[model samples]
Structures are given as structure tokens and as C-alpha cells.
Target: MNNKDMKIHLTVDVWAAQKADARAVRFDVFVIEQKIPVELEWDDMDEHCLHAVAYDAAGHAIGTGRLLPDGHIGRMAVRAAGRGKGVGAAILKALMAQARQRGDAEVVLNAQTQAEAFYGRYGFSRDGEEYYEAGIAHICMRHVFS
Candidate 1:
């Protein structure tokens, strides 16, 4: 755990001022860096999703992810400066903890093909065939609750 012990204390409301950092991190990673279409990067579902934003020691947001009400996790993004420093892992652990607290039977995500092993390291199992979304390869993965 980092400074906040991996607790995602940001407001889940998309309209909240707290969401700006999360949005910035995602936009930088998905839209600018990955070239994902802007239209594909946002959705109405964000209004109801639980979001987790990771902050660097300097208090700048560096990573983020969301856990949908239906237990589908997505929008995982980490800035280049934040990768491999456990920022992604902290955000993910926070999101999955939120899901478990809500009694979700399982947590699911469409992980980038390259991140399959990373998610697998957290007990997520891949399912179905690989597919392309926003021109990036992805595979569905799930982590069942015990």
C-alpha cells in the first residue's frame, strides 16, 4: 500500500470535482498515448461506476480504473511514469476490494492482451477469444470471489 494504504477515497460521482484527476490520467493514457478514439474513451456508464485513482508521492494522479455496478472493471490506465512502481496494482487492489465489499460474485475486466499476465497474477482467469476494441487487443478476464 502507498500513502493511503490503497484505499480509493475519491468521490465515485463522475460530476464530482474529484473526478478531474482520474479523467486526466485516463485521457493521457488512452486517448493521447494509445491513440484510442475520444468517443470510445468515455461513456454514460461512468456516472454509475466506482472509480479508483492512484496518486504519486507528489499528490498527482498517475493511475486509475473503474468498477462498474455490474462488477465489470475497465478503464485501467497508468501513466508511463507510474508503471511498474505498484501504482496499477494499488488501484486494482482497491477496486477489487470495493467489489468484494459489495458482495459481487466475481470481478471481471477486458484487459489489454499485453496485460493478461499482470491481471492473472492477481487471480484473474482469462475467458473467451481475443477481441479488438479501439484497435487494441483485449481479452476478457474474471476473478471469482471465494
Candidate 2:
């Protein structure tokens, strides 16, 4: 269905980094769909990060993202069914809110080349030349809070 015709109900929650729902959504989008290595998917940093998960009306996790203590945002993923439904934006917003609440002056993220424009819309600007991570093209992006 087209976006306008679809019923879009998204609930975003911020929690400790290892929350199951957040991990599940990231697994589906990153490891499963994008083929990122399992070893790279689960990292030591998770325990110290702030996580955001987006759930649909059916209570299924649809998207996830994380904000690191050093103001780095990463691991953003949105399930295929949730694409174009604003689920990713919801997840990012939740992460950014948490960052602001923590008194961060800015947040940085490595945006997949194809999704750079998506982050750009949120006021993130490219900070470096394109590079590869997990064998996929990416570029560093940063958003400064005013």
C-alpha cells in the first residue's frame, strides 16, 4: 500500500543498549538483510550505549538505533516492512532526544551511502570522504544541536 493509505503507528522507546527488542530489529535489518558479520553486530560498546527501538501497532519491533556515550549514533536499522513508514525517523528522533537530555553538543554517525540523504534531512552533514564498513559504502555524518 502507498504511504498515505497505510496505517502508520510507531512507538519509539529508549532503553539500555542490550534490550532484546532493539537487538532483534538490528539483527533482522543488519545481520540478516545487510549481511553484516555476527561478530560485528554484537559489540562491547552496546552495554554503555543508549538504545532506541521502534515498535509497530502489532508490537513487533520495526526499527532500532543507538547513541554512544561519546555522542556517536550508530546501528540504525529499519525492517523492510517499515521502510518509508517513518519508523527510521522515529528511532533516530528517540536517540537524538536521549542525547539532548544527556547534554550532548552533537552526535556523529556513519551513514550508509544510500541512506546518507535520509540522515541529511535531520540536519546531519557529511564530514568525510566515502569509506567502506562491513563491505558497504559509508560516510561520516554529524549533527550539531543548537
Candidate 3:
């Protein structure tokens, strides 16, 4: 389907997993689908971070991401069915908005090698050498804005 045919909803909440259906989407895409260890998939910092999810017109969560007070954006996930539909981009944009609302000057993320170009589209620039995280090659990226 075309992006214009898709509807994206974005929100930030303290209960990161209150949207069980949405968190399931993250689990499927990040853990089970990508073979990432469940233990590494989550961190204690979630309790303090702002979580955002993108829902489709029918209300099923299609994408998800989070923003930490220090300007870190993490746990971005898009369901397989939502891939290529601009869901990821919408979620990232929401996270950046949250950062700006909190007066952050920049947002940072460790993007998977395959997704570097995707983040680049949102103005994130590669900042360091590649490294391994959760058994996947990743690069540090940052988006600076006024």
C-alpha cells in the first residue's frame, strides 16, 4: 500500500508497555524476528524514558520508538507488515518532536548498519565507527536541530 493510504498515530507515555499489542510488535520485530536476546532487548532505563508508538487506522500499533531525557532515541521497531509504508519514519519523527519539546538540542541513536540510510533521511549523521550491539553491527548517529 502507498504511504498516503496509511494513517500513523504518535504518542508518548510513561507506561512503555501499556500498549501490549504495540509492545508485541516490537518483540516480534526486534526479538523473535531479529533473534535479539530478550534480556538485551529491554533495559531498566525504559521506566524513565518516553515511549512512542504509531498506530494504524484500525488502531493496531505498526511502529514504536522511545526518547530518553538525555536525548537518546531507542527501541524503534516496525512490524513486518508495516515495513516500507513509512511507519518507521513517522515514529522517528515523533521521537524527535518529543526531544525538541523537552528542550533537547539533539537526538542520538545507535542505528543498525542496514538502517543507517533510513535514519539519515531524518537528518541523522553517522558519528562513529561501527560497533556490535545485540549481535548486530551498528553505528552511532545523531540529529542536531535548533
Clash counts per candidate, in order, are 0, 0, 0
lDDT per residue for candidate 2 within 26-48, as digits (tens), equals 88888889999989889888887
TM-score of each: 0.90, 0.89, 0.91
Candidate 1 per-residue C-alpha lDDT over 1-146 given as tens digits, one digit per residue, 9 for 90 to 100: 55534333333434254478888998999999999989989898877888888776667888888989999998999888888777788778888999999899999999999999899999999999999988889999999999
What does the lDDT come to for candidate 2?
A: 0.83
- What pairs collide in candidate 2? none
Q: In candidate 3, how many Å is residue 2 off?
A: 6.7
**Candidate 3 residue lDDT tens string, 1-146:** 37443676666787546457556877999888999988887777777888888888788888888888799998899887778888888788878988998899999999999999999999999998999988899999999995
The TM-score obtained by model 1 is: 0.90
As a whole number from 0 to 100, the lDDT of residue 112 in candidate 3 is 93
Q: Ten consecutive residues with minimal summed lDDT in candidate 3? A: 1-10
TM-score, cand. 3 vs. native: 0.91
Q: Model 2, stretches more than 4 Å misplaced? A: 1-18
